[model samples]
Target: MVVAAVLASGLLLAGPALRRRYPVAWWLLCGFPVVAFRVVHTWRPLMAGCGLAVSRRPALTVVSGLVGKGAPPPQPRVPRRGLIRPTAGGFVLLVRLLPGQVPEHFVKAAPAMAENWQVHAVRVTSWKPGIVRIVASAADPLTDPRIPKQRGPGHLLRVTVGALETGAAWVVDLRRIPHWLIVGATRSGKSTLINALVAGLAPQAVALVGIDCKGGMELSLYEPRLSALATNREQAVRLLAALVDLTLDRMTLCRVARVRNIWGLADKERPVPVVVIVDEIAELFLVASRSEKDEAHAAGTALIRLAQLGAALGVFLVVAGQRVGSDLGPGVTALRAQLGGRVCHRVADPGTAEMALGDLNPDALKAAQAIAPEQAGTAVLASGDGWERARSHLITEAEAEAVAAEYAHLTPVLSELHVEAL
Candidate 1:
């Protein structure tokens, strides 16, 4: 009984402190007391209220002492205010909807609003609980954090999709899993997100290679940091060849060391993981002629190999493209299987959205389609454990750029893949 009292007291004191420190955790922890109350109510009617009252008193007391009652309560969210007046000179305008509004209304109204407002962007922010925000450029200075230049490369990379809601962000420890599939429509912030990832990894002590199919326009920005970049059909194939060879070499290294997971070894002794980012995957598979079948087959096979075996060898792939369809080529389904870490942004069609999120829950697929175009940076991320959750946080281009710039300084030296020539 004495120990129980001590633990209760500690919990009362430390619980609020922990909630304050980790707001996201607070969301999860808030349910505990309610659940306890429910469970206790079934057995001992009076204990539910009594326990809640007792537990809350101490927590409230600590919180009250920390921030006196005179202090204003923290605001959950601020009004969407801007430097320019809502009706004033050119600026981004967004329309938000309250819960239970019709989604069709927003879908129908989006184009007209874009035209009438002369807005560059108009998107539905939410559905079910409907809200919309439209962005228009201002004549004055740009205050948007999504702008790439302000935050630089470091800011753009590795955004916690739940940051705005949770108020805490994390650099998803990718070492735990080996590959990710990044799918979004054109200009749906796919390339910008990739830029952010490269920038995030640039400074890390890891090997980086890129296959830019759009004539290297996307990945070329960080030539200063990239160890290897492949631009066309030939180059992309060659790059994949080199990566496969490198994966084999790493496997041999791991075999000799008698280690499985790299994390099992000491940090200094572990091999540096190689991360390969492929932009515009269609280029590798969309071959026009039968004569090119051999090359396409080789490229597709190499990609599958990387996805299946790369994680064990400490090699990872981040595959991004406008659309991921079986129509794109034969190996699409095979590659998708290996990419367990999946993130889907707003897409042009239900089919594309289905392609990205179909394997998961039916409700999640509905949520993916219902995603408002205005929520471009918003995505649904699923981990490798088969547990999936939807996240509705906006990742601005500027935020990504900022992340990229930060890690650009510590860019690691490029090392050759110790394998036979292709």
Candidate 2:
């Protein structure tokens, strides 16, 4: 008995440390069963308490048909529950909602469910008709997300940057959704995310073109792997125009090959894919004087054209900026519509977050707005599918620079894009 007591006390003392070191193990061995039991035990009452339970009674059965001799009214019917499945960071269950109950009902009750389950958050998503999937995380996955190992070969135009709130990998698949708009304030991990993205793409056989109008302050680190680098607004304009010309050339190639897009062409005949990284996009749009207005307009038109036709012509855009608002120009709004993928980090103003996610998902806008300054890499990303909180893995400038240098030999020489020579 004394030995058992000593062992129990030791485990009690080491519980937190073990949980911190091995969260998945601790959750599976210690937390899952308890949480599972709580979910099953309280589900009925919890549903009824949240007003999700529906009464089963006929309108004609008033006053129980007897003052004191009638049987007690039947309890409300709760939603049917499915098997509770455990995940790496949490658990998921399916619920067949009662009649008149929509997925929105469950979504509205997610906070209550989380509170009762003593979990960090609960997400309710429509799994099928009349069925909703509830995913509950025991803790915040973004606190210290584990980075997945780099594999030998990855899918083309796809990079796994970090982990999502659902504990799944946060991937940016440029092929699936070509253009991206990344907006974040200074030190909010905007640059870090770009570094991770570029580092992931560095080893791939893709032509990287950079237009950093900040005089090569940020993107110059990847100069080794880039086919073209434009530093000033003047050079950016020339480089963008050159890219437009290159796309037109590719379009002609596709037309002659009888292919719809570049991807449909034979691999041997396909031109190397081009990824344009535009850092500080506001620099290309903001006009200082009347003389620069036409220059800004030209830059904006070039970007809009790229965003319109780049995805089909083997050119993709990753546009990042500290601040992006409609007040910048109507061109900003037009460009925003073309970029389907948005990652909004902690922004200095609500307008940036709105510009990034408002049209896509209002809830995502709220989530992005809630990102604290301390949560640097944490962002709210939204596409046509939905929105979720995610964090990008940290990739320092030196690491990105090294990766660029390591893949310098793979850089495709596109003579047409040599803006410096032009």
Candidate 3:
């Protein structure tokens, strides 16, 4: 005991003083007493003490769950009707609720259950009360082959995000949702995913336009397909006004046909869906203070109107940004209402992540941040259908170029009237 006490005292007294002077020697010396004490006694306390010391600093927690023996795994339970089997990182619940039985009931349950698990659900069947075949949650979104691989084979030539499974093929039936909100920190694969969407939709006959406030870096590569590219305040205003006009024309088309939604009508009668992709939304609000309020007001209102009514008129907006707080102004709040699909990547601040994903799945924000920087192409995706922690497929510049080359042959010749739709 005396020898142990003296050795520990020497370590405590000399370790810090010597560390900065000679880290190697200090570490070597520190290990002797540490190993000796651990050898003679249960090592838990010493390790715990060191951990507590380290935790005092401002760093991400290095330790995860306890390493000790844990409770025995739960006994395998028969899946109840409307409940699916839980996987390694998520739960799969089947629902027996019919289309109208309880729609929001499932949607509202996410924020409540998101604290413990990520959730996803797809309707399979509701023929019986105790038997629903819904896929509630998945460990990762990209892991499923059924979700979709691309929008179309030779379309959005650039795929900076997720892609179709290697052997599996599927197309996203966008008749489901009208608008999507994409958020991520810079270089977190936001633009990449958008490329994938474009590549997916490129083969389909659709009008493509882009509002790139940071010059045209994100969309300029596909200038051949982009009908219009907005780089600044004046251009954004013009571009949005053009979109409003197009929306009105489409509305006129819908009103004339007395149709509520495009999909509700015959495919031949429906107008081709127009997609608008906006990058760096914060720049719209980040103009000089001296800028005229009228311009800001016009821009804000146009975006909000698009967010609110564009969906029903066969217009979809894919808005991306770093932050969506009060810093960006009031327009974002209004726009949030219309964006039903949410995807979030890592953010520098938790508050930013919260703002982007809180409405859909609070847990997703943290999951997005938790994704390692090395895993750059991954993100957390949440939609009206369900939530999925997915890895956005890495669309390299080379791959985008390749896809663009292939789809160039299929690019539709834009009509003169389609010029304004850009």
Candidate 4:
């Protein structure tokens, strides 16, 4: 009895701490009692409170033959049927909708549900027939602290970038979405996200190319693994021209062989795949003087062409910047539109998030803009269907450099792949 009392007191003291430090796990652990209260109406204080919250209405007493003044009328409870399953950063509820209700109704009531559950937010997705999935969460997912790595390239040019809010590992297949645009403010773990990506690809047989407009201060660190590096506008222009030429060569080969894409050919006959990583993409498009405008236009044209035609030719792009706005240059808007994959981290302004994900989903724009500085590496990732809150694994610069150096031999030469047809 003494030990039980001590343990109870300790748990009572830890309640606030756990909710603040590890909300996701704590809520999941407490789910059993919460669910029980929803069903059984247990007598314990916590259980009783949860039961009251889920109940349709509270019993009212007649005072002076009338209801008490200032006593608000009870509201009907939402008819819910589901079980909670703990996920990586949250919990998923395989819920069944009530008659005349659709998933959109639940989506509209998500905020109210979040308030009742005391979670940060919730996302509603249709699971099947009459089933809906409610993903609820509080804490950041990157707190998992697991170092990110890929087993091997899968069905497509797949790479693991982070974990989705549903607690599942999220992979981005470049074959499906060939061009990606990543936006984040400084110190928002944008560099770490890039490092995780580079590390994931180090063991694969692919060419890693770079364009660092930051005077090579960034991409230069992985020089040992990069097949080509560009530090300035002049270098970027030349490198881009070469990439375009290679894409043209592959295009011709595909047409001549009557194959739709390079991947349709046998491995030995296929050209080497290339992944171009660009740091501070806006710098490559911005021109200060009339003397540089012509060069900038050409460089921009090359990048747009690569994004449009590279998906089938085995050329992929990962372009990142502190902020990407239409005012950057003449072709900036066009280039942004072509990038099918969008990752927005904690940005300095709502406008940056707007520019990144607004066209895809306006709701995603709000989610991306709301990311706090403390949640670095946590981003709003948007694709064709929808967006999800995800957290990228933290990989340090040194670790990325080491991985690059270890697999430097796997890097492919563009010239070898750009051979003239026999």
Candidate 5:
């Protein structure tokens, strides 16, 4: 321990680069003994605040043994015998799994841990097979947004959202999941998320499509970047129908060329990849008038078909809704099934949270529903993997418009297809 401490101190005192390069070793050596012996016993009150430990059993001291009983035992020291890691946002309590305690036990006690640790929040995840790691944040990292860069594969999508509670940068790769479901309340930063996606994807070699059923108030400004935009039920139906036709054409093109998907085709022969963003998805199913019911159904069916088969043929979906529920109408549930990636912000009800999280640990649902108004851009996101707390960058309408104008020339003309609709 002395040697490690000496080496760590020397290296860290020597240079910043060395400290950055060997941070883990430095922190482990510099912190282990000090934290384990010096701080553990002193923080007894704070440790027990999480209700994870019991008071120490009173020892039969000489006076106690003689008197048959004594006043009481001193408080128990915390049993967190492991490493103390100073991460970006706060500290990580990493310990080997105890005999009867699982990672869930710590996770279940996160709220208390956060309060006792005097942190903004806390999350517990299994670092490895037999390790439990509790990450606590001194400040809410989501409050500080992260701007995404326009780089990555033409087909592969990566959007830099917010940071994790551990202060690690959070990004979602749409190529891996192919589609996403974003559920949030009206002021829950759904528009900001779409802006982030557009900002990142505009400069890439892909086509952007928008279905802004809210009278195009959300996405019409990006007309310079979007290959197509649908604002009403009739327009949406025609636009989705055209996309369906385009998807079928791509499939036939792939078969004729003896390839499986768009990626398998030679770059020169491939068509432009497509990413469709649907804002206020509930509007498509709201059929206000009896005369428009058929159009609404057709639009929903076409959109569902796109979700079902678009991924393999160089297409992706980013569907957002204020409230995603069965009450939205028929086919809502089926359409949701295709969305492998899920992002949930502060929802008005528990069911919206449930639809976004879907059988995830109940903790995630609770977390989503519990999102306070102070954290507008923050959200709970789940994909094929697990979930994380994320936030979209503050890309306003003006910034998005500038980006669209900058990349407007790159927007290709689809002469063969009806450009007015799709």
Candidate 6:
């Protein structure tokens, strides 16, 4: 008995350290069963308490009493619950909503459910018609996310940059979503995300083109792997025009080959993919003179064109900036529409968050705006599917530069995109 008591006390003392260091293991071993039992035990009362239960008709009760003497009255029907499944950091269950109950009802009740379950938070999402998925995390996974290192060359154009709020890897697949807009203020992890992305793409066969209008200060680190780099608005306009011509060339090749997209062509015949990384996009639109204005117009038009046709022609865009608002011009808005994927970190202005996620999901905009200034790299990303909170992995400039140098030999040279000549 003494030995057992000592062991129990030791485990009690070590519980928090274990939870902090190995969250997934601790959750599975100690958290899941208790939460699962709570879910099952309190389900009926919880649903009724949340006003999700539908009461039986009083007239039916009377009729039943008369027809079958002393029969019990029917009880309110609660939504059917599915088996609770455990995730790395959470538990998920499906609820077949009662008649007149929508997912919104569950969403509205999520806070209360979390309070009762003693979990960090609960999210309700529509799984399908008449069914809602309730996911409850035992603790916030984003406080310190652990991302596994890449073992080998990852899938083409897909990079696991960080961890999502759900404790899943946050993957940025350029092919799945062709273009992206990443907005964050200084030291808000905007530059860090770009570093992570470029580092991931460095070893791939794809060509990396950079238009860092801030005199190439940010992108020059990867010069070893970059096929082209533009330092100023004038050079950016010329480089973008060259990219448009390159896309047209690919389009003509596809036409001649009778293929709708470059991917449809034979691997040997397909052109190498091009990924354009535009830093400080506001610089491209912020003009003070007629020449700069013309240059800005030209740059924006080229970008819009690229965003429209880039996906099909094996070209992708990752446009990042500190501030992007409609005030920049109508072109900024137009470009935002085409860039289906958006990642908004902590910003100085509400307009940037609105512009990033307003059209897709208002809830996402609120979440983005709620990002604390101290939460570097924490962002709310939205696409056609939905939105979620994520944080990019920290890849310092030196690491990214080393990755670029390691794969410099794989850089594909495109003479037409040579900005040095321009």
Name the best candidate (by TM-score).
2
Question: Would you list the rank order by lDDT, best first?
Answer: 6, 2, 4, 5, 3, 1
TM-scores vs. true structure, each candidate: 0.59, 0.94, 0.62, 0.79, 0.79, 0.93
Per-candidate local distance difference test: 0.58, 0.92, 0.60, 0.76, 0.75, 0.92
Candidate 5: tens digits of C-alpha lDDT, residues 1-422: 99988876786586465435644454454433444344355445655665555545455564475466655455554546466667644676776654556778777777776665456777788888778777766666676643335455344466665566556776767678888999889889888888878877887788898888888999987989888888776777778888898899999999999988888999899988889899988888887788678877787898789998898898899999899888877678888888888889998888888877866556678778879977888888876556788877778888989989999987866643344634
lDDT (tens digit, per residue) of candidate 4 on 248-332: 9999999998999998998889987899999998788788898688888988899999999998999999999998887787587
lDDT of 6 by residue, 354-401 (tens): 999999998899999999989998999999998889999999878988
Ten-residue region with minimum lDDT total, candidate 4: 39-48
- Residues 1-422 of candidate 2: C-alpha lDDT, one tens digit per residue: 99988866876788799898988888886788889999999999999999999877764563555445687777778999999999988899999988888999899999999999999999998999999999999989899998897774488889989889988889999999999999999999899999989988987889999999999999999999999999999999999999989999999999999999999998899999999999999999899898578888999999999999999999999999999999899999999999999999999999999999999988889889999999999999999998999999999877987888888999999998998687
Model 4, runs deviating above 4 Å: 1-89, 96-102, 118-120, 126-131, 144-156, 416-422
lDDT of 3 by residue, 1-422 (tens): 99999987997898788865654366456633443333235223322332211133222222222224443332222222332343332234454442334434444434433322233323232334644443333223354322334434443222324422121122234446667777877887787777777766666677777788788877777666665677777688777877787788878888878888666678888766778888877777665666645666777788888877787887788888877775666777778777887777777677667777787765566567687766565677777655555555555676666666766655544343343444
Model 1 spans with C-alpha error above 4 angstroms: 1-171, 265-269, 384-410, 415-422
TM-score of candidate 4 against the unseen true structure: 0.79
Between 3 and 4, whose TM-score is larger? 4
Q: Worst lDDT window (10 residues) for model 3?
A: 163-172
Error of 2 at 162 (Å): 1.1
How good is model 2 by TM-score? 0.94
1 or 3, which is superior by TM-score? 3
Candidate 1 lDDT, tens digit per residue, 1-422? 99988866776677778655653344344423443333233322222222211232355665785677565433222122222223222223233432334444555555454444444333333322434443332221111222222232343223332321112232345666568887888756566566655655665667677788789887767655566777776777777877788778777777777888665677787766678888888778887788577677878899999998887777788998878888877698889878877777777767766666787545457656666766655555565343232333343556545644655655555455321233
